[model samples]
Target: MIKHLRGVWISCLLILGVGPSAGWAGVDSDISSSRYPSIQAALDANPGKVVEVAPGIHEIHDTIRIVTAGGGLVGSGRIIQMDPARPIVRIDHASGATLRGLTLTRPEGRRETESEAVIATDTHDLALVDLRVIDNQTRGAAIELRNCVDGQIRNCLVQNYQRVAVDDRTATPDQGFAFRCIIGTGILIRECQGTLIQGNRVREDRLVATPEVKRQHGLGQIIKKNAVRGRIASQRDWDRGETDNWMQGTAIHVGSPETTDNTQVIGNLVERAGQGFDIHADHVILSQNIVNDALVGMKAMHGSKHVIVTGNQFIKNTLWSIGMMPGASSLPSRAAQGGQPARAANVDGGSIIANNIITDFGLGQTRWIWGEENVGCPIRFDHGQVPENPPLVDVIIQGNLVYDTGRDTLIKEGKPEVVPPRYRYAVLVESGPSAPVGLHFSNNLFHPGVRGISNIELKP
Candidate 1:
């Protein structure tokens, strides 16, 4: 068979050494310039080397710092281009690095803000493969693993990041795994530790803003300075003000809770953000993702624990398609603070919001749970003046499918009614008899289009 395909292409060109001279094996011992000229002089001419950055566009003007220690930094199909005015690569305290098939661009008239294209601080076992962070005016985050530890960002292609597109801060928020990124925010896990955000393609560009009017003159009309406020300021009048600027941000922004237990956001394909996955961290696991045109589609906040939102696919989100805020004070339990465990009470008893598919387009405001109150005293409060109602004790919302293209989908407001009494189930809650557990909403599937009350009762 053609001599075994020429002996498997000569053993993959002798395991990719393809010698005819191309430099990179501990930095330039030979192999005359095709564009090496600096990547920190090819890592200071091979310090703990294992280089191989061949292939085209290597512009870079500064910040390619790789304080090596033990091999691995391959970009065999190079294109590190960055000068987005200037500010590319910067792996200061490196340790076992491995950057493959690069292509990090930046120069669209570089603005500033610590102008970053790459910056892995306090590094440790790193691995950024198949990269391609383009555009870059001042934040096309292709990769920025700070205080790194065993890291790994796969198949990248983070685009136009004006703000956050893979910024793993790493004090240990699950450690790493950002697969298939195409067009920004597809990943932003803060503190780091075994994190994994799979299959990405976040899209943003739709928030629509500019339209407001209010006038009431039934029993209230006293502003006669030239009287002419007959209230005629319309964008079709009232119900057309939710589209704010498409691509508003966040296709993934897991902030960190001390490595939030084996976190994982699977199968992504979000669109037009203002919100599309902003999980806070703690044993999280969101599956089969595919959100569209978001104003808000998934916003689980602080104290996140043992969360598991499954089988996703929320389309046309003008607003609200799963939102849980849990976290106001207890100070992580009272004192642990930033690292965790002062009062450390989240994970409100095993959460499992299952099988999803929401489609709200009535112009926003679908679901929201604020919960906040933990700072010191008060034990518990959900706005109704303590009478034996503690607050979200456990959760589980099953079988989903809500399409409210027009008739407002669900809202439960909360406030200073004195505090203490939280229960709002939507379905299946055969009597826990205490008065505050509402929000169980069984079987789901509600889309008859509007009249105000697919589920709502909030006045505290």
Candidate 2:
């Protein structure tokens, strides 16, 4: 665990003649919404007490900043925005503070940058619990924790945050820079230590942010027992295209590069997303998670080290399930984007991929993605390409079950140019930078036969 951030402070303002928006209890320790004009007014009192909001719509002007510590912000009502461009709440430079039972909705037609509903940065000993951000406005992140330690987001439900909410449709999914920068995640933990994000649901809406960039290293964070599903769409999106657009969000994207270490992703169900667990960190563990119905299930992009992908299920994914490619090709700018990093960095250290269930659609699982060739396999490594990237290191693939794979695993016949499909391969390791430093394979199970697994230096 990293050290806690300390000695951080933000100045608070006391709006004198300008009273709180509503009623004010005008007391300390225990405050009520009707008693205060606005939620920010109660927080400004600095009584170190619980501020309870009534069951109604509380509109605010500025970002409600928390500069003091040791209090609670509890509301059974909704916090709407008078200024849609600004955030709803911000928790900073405070500890032992609790934000619970609140529903914050962003307004429509925000012309400014991406906006987050709740953000906690550089704080400790905080808890965000039982918050329902429902029918949320566009560009909504229920909670975003940055440089925060000893914080937890528990039992929260953030639903129906549209990806983009402007009048123009200039940016398509192909031009995904806006999505990468928007505050569209259910929860985003960046450059934090010892954080626990448990029992949260980020459902509906086909919009998200991908930190595939090389910043914000996360440490000692655990994302467990959460359900990140994109099976349903908004009424507006459903009218445009049904399942075609419903399953189009990235469930979880971890980007630390060298900063994030020893992070754990466990016991989560990610379904109907465009991508799942797109990771670019080191010493990460992805275990006991369910990844299904996506273009790419999981990936180690740009560059990574010491990743263990085990005890998981990759089922019915449209394209290659797991891939090891430079992330340069996956970001907003690619080789074609002039100066942008084309792929992720290089990979190093020993890794393990074991004891997982990887399934294919027998013969009918064929789709072209990102303008790539059609594929019906679970695992992929760059095969026999030129040696431009760094050499891949030691790998061990063992004790995994493969079902109905070979039908689309390989080319069927002799022409070699026009190839047909066959149920032949389960794993494909082709031209890498160089021969792997050490490669081992053992005890793999194939459902139909054993013809498709290829390119193993050391075989079972």
Candidate 3:
């Protein structure tokens, strides 16, 4: 039986003191210092220890809390060089800790709002290998997991988060801006579960920090400006009165449900980011990623269900690169509509959006699948509104490849809007009365030139 379950998982890690030679008490309790006077006294004299930080610069002012629960803290070939502006390391309430090959920085203005160079909370089985979180001014989410769970943020190299690097929020305030700023969103799983944010390199193009709006007389508006030109670092700003000012900043903002199922955002390389990867979790799995640019490169709103965004690579996002905003309209229309009749009426199910590769160079090369009714205009779903019962549902644009720049690829229905062109096999089936029942557009590949396949039948 697999070696008796690996000898009962190493005898429950030697009764929980996390055995592997319990807390190394050798080499004169090694605690090298170029400047970390006391990172919780070098992790409480190295509990479940293995400290050996050597590569220069180490200036932490406070907050390196590690409440080792089942003991296990190793830092092989270390290099704890911090002070990019503050927040060196703060892994509060720890568990099976493992932070390998470190190198975190942060100088200029000592970054603010609890500056982060590393911050985990109410921890769990954590593991962050091959680390290198650099250039910190305001956000370089090198590592920031709050209210943690079974974690594993592997092969890291989170870069210059002058704003947000790897932040994972828990105490939901509308579940927005969880990992804001930029460096890389290599790994950011919120409210956490069996997490694993593999192979990292999440980059962002600054211009974040716009929060402080409370208007409606209560007055608090701050919108310090940032449509995408610069300076944006505000966290949260509430105002549900609606004016189409629903901001949610991101680079990986997976909030909602303080604990769902097994989470996995496989093979990473998410670049830029004014907004990219904003999943709300629920049996997640965003495989083989390499999303570039950013304005919207994979946004799965609130009611997120059995998710599975396969073989990814949606480049040059300026808008609609893979969206699904099932907000408002009550909610439970099979949990925001998708496929399998929202999973046979159970409500929220469908989400297989398979075999990906959506590219768009710039200037109106839009429409890569927006929500609601799948509006057209560089993509705009929820914006089209619809979902009172079995009303909204029509998403299963199979086998991908929506490459445009040579123009022509508009698929719309209803409201005097009918614009179509790029057709290498068009199949717009919307057989009325509540539509949606296995809407598949089989084996796809639509380049700018076109081929042969047109079967339009709208009118819902």
TM-score of each: 0.32, 0.63, 0.31
In Å, residue 25's CA in model 3 sits off its true spot by 42
| Residue-level lDDT tens digits of model 1 in 1-460 | 9999999998888578775443333233322224456556666767777566656666666666667765445654545444444456667577767665566665445522335566566666666655666554333334556556556565555555544223321222221112111124445656665656566564533222212100111111111111121122222212332112223356567766545456677887766555678776677788998877555678564456567888898765543557653433102234665885555444333567777876544233212211221111100112111222233435566676664433332333642232221112211122232322434545655443222222243221
| Model 3 TM | 0.31
Q: Tell me the number of clashing residue pairs for each predicted model.
A: 62, 32, 30
Put down candidate 3 lDDT per residue, 154-243, tens digits, no spaces. Answer: 767765454333343323333333322223333455677878878777664343322322222222223232233211223333232121
The C-alpha lDDT values of all candidates are 0.49, 0.57, 0.52
lDDT of 1 at 262: 61
Q: Rank candidates, TM-score, best first.
A: 2, 1, 3
List candidate 1 segments past 4 Å from native.
Answer: 1-36, 40-56, 59-65, 68-157, 160-185, 192-250, 259-275, 281-296, 301-315, 318-322, 325-343, 347-451
Residue 281 in candidate 3, Cα distance off native in Å: 1.9
Top candidate, metric TM-score: 2
Q: Which RMSD values do the candidates have, in order?
A: 22.0, 15.0, 19.7
What lDDT does model 3 reach? 0.52
**What is candidate 1's CA lDDT for residue 426?**
17
